[model samples]
Target: MPVAAVALVAGAVGAGPVIAAVQGDPALPERTAEQLLADAVRAARSDPRPMSGTLMQTSSFGIPGLPQVSGAGGSSPGALLAGSHELKVWYGGADRIRLALPGRMSETDLVVDGDRVWLWESGTNTATRITAGREDLAGHGRAPGDRAAEALPTAATPQQIAREVLERADADTAISVTGDEKVAGRDAYQLTLAPKDEASLVREIRLALDGETLVPLRIQVYAEGSAEPAFEVGFTTVTFSPPAPENFAFTPPPGAKVQEKALADLVPGPVGGQEKGEELADGAEVVGEGWTAVAVLPFSEKDLRGLASQKGQGAGSADAGAAEAAVESLLKSAERVDGAWGGGRIVRTKLVSALLTDDGRLLVGAVTPERLVEVAGQK
Candidate 1:
């Protein structure tokens, strides 16, 4: 499993929740559905106070014969997602946060303070940093960078999840305050989003919000027709009280090699920026809506090169060409799949689906492979 995980990190490896209907009435929300969602947005935006917790990500899918993807040690691909992991996390709002995962030797940390972001790897006693607006991407920077699969999904906060869920409120989304429950040791309200789109593979998405704070406490994603959640993430232990100020500060360990670079240099010019009147052709357009919205990105040689570059730039290693070669070798071993719509390789998990098409495009979504493939051919 460890070896596979390591391979997944090398490959940058790659969901459903189906909830049963409530039998009887539970505690009703004092606030209306709109009011509750608005409150959640406010809580997340206003939460500058320090918070600490243990995060759990459980993945149980039916994806078969897939390769490992990227992430922290022991937190890669198959086993890491299918099994349970305890990640100790501290947040001091957007600019300051830390994630720690224990490994065989030392703990791995992805810490961001101010303009600098640092990634610490186990056993090597090394740290890598990237400053804002730089050209070369660091060990996976925050938003606007590295949106691919990582164990820590730096941007996947409760508030962000809530925002995405609520922003898509429209005809296709059915919003209801289903019930009330306890989350992070606090009374909370249950909100369910069920999809009305027949093309969508999603069954439902549920969020638990603190009754007082309105911050989302948990999010579960269920696929069509499945009672089990394909993806679930929530805090097992949490505290709203401000975390110690020291949690936001960090100093590279003595003798640790610290290399700094700009992410822009690593990104292809077209993806990194756009000219005055030029617009993206099929680049990163949002399809579907509400619970089934998918992000389809234009992928070609440049994107592949960027991924290969990211592989080589990992903190513990320094082998750009070899990393690119490794990626090539990995791709060679992938199971080639074709469908009526088109031909491509399906990299999937129970909760998530992504495909690299023969037409130089990548379609990704929480929906099933069929949905992604359908979108792939259309675009």
Candidate 2:
């Protein structure tokens, strides 16, 4: 399986051991950072092993009032790194993956087998399924009603996050090996990447690579001008043996609802619901690249109304009014501003900045608010 495939499983279904092993100081052999990173890529490409582990996540920055607008919480990567959470995982290849999140009353699970995926809420005895080619039942990057997609646990896996940063490293990034550290009872190389661009909101990104397998053990992201990391994700306890096949199998209860959906329906819709740039973005413009990039999306009338309609639950319903009001409340935190791209509210956080136009469009990026506004005009 591709490394990216494993990442999808980790992000949506987190896991690791709950108990920490006795701490030990282990000295690691000297190796160039490039060698370590290359080994990581090799490990990802070489073999797909069955691994089970414990994991956790937390976050601080979110859109003040409008939760969705922040796009930081829920099954989002942001949420995976914010707050407190713990989970367990079992992975066996393309045909099988299992996640167990313990709750106060029961456990929630996501299981994948071959062409179908299942989400079971043990507490409610309910299950949802997404069959192959079932577009209507899925959404970009996740399945409907899947808590991992709707909201992430408080944690991420280093293999998932570090791989992405390594692949994107280039002239815009300053990469270096910063010695070694112990993670999950293993001595690992520490690789760090700092953005060369001053406009980038991120100050640095660090990854710990397992010395033997080359898989990443931990990943951390730091904000500009901050001494500490804003977010982190990693495994606590893990094993390399393959998990049992039965872990991926699922059967709904007698009274449970098993709605089946085609996978094709889950793709992201074209931006503005138009077909010109199906690949550009789901509904936004990507300006620049690497760490300095910005996304300018039109979030005006049609988009807002579409969101309102869903949350509203129907046409001419109180839910719609409530949704609209909620949106207004979220946008209220933005400061009023007028510019070449017209007027909109600007919202800033430690690592992200965005503009919400009076007319409804939004300009967002990790860079300065001025950079987003500049990109907005060009768009």
Judging by TM-score against the true structure, name the best candidate. 2
- Candidate 1: where are CA atoms >4 Å away? 1-29, 45-48, 67-82, 133-155, 263-284, 292-357, 367-379
Tens-digit per-residue lDDT, 1-379, candidate 2: 0122222322221222222323355567777767766666667555456687876543344445433322223332223332445567787864566776765466677777755677676666667675554232333533332212222322335665665677777777777885457777776777888888888777887777776677777776667766555555667777777887887778897888677644433223321123323555556666787777776766764675577667566334764676677567656767777877688778776667778787667776677787877876776
Task: Assess candidate 1 and give its TM-score to the true structure.
Answer: 0.68
- lDDT by residue for model 1 (188-255), tens: 78877777776566677788876666667777766677777655567767787766777767789788
Q: RMSD in angstroms, candidate 2?
A: 6.7
Worst 10 residues of 2 by lDDT: 1-10
Model 2 stretches astray by more than 4 angstroms: 1-26, 44-47, 66-82, 133-156, 264-278, 301-326
Superposed by TM-score, candidate 2 places the C-alpha of residue 315 at a distance from the truth, in angstroms, of: 18
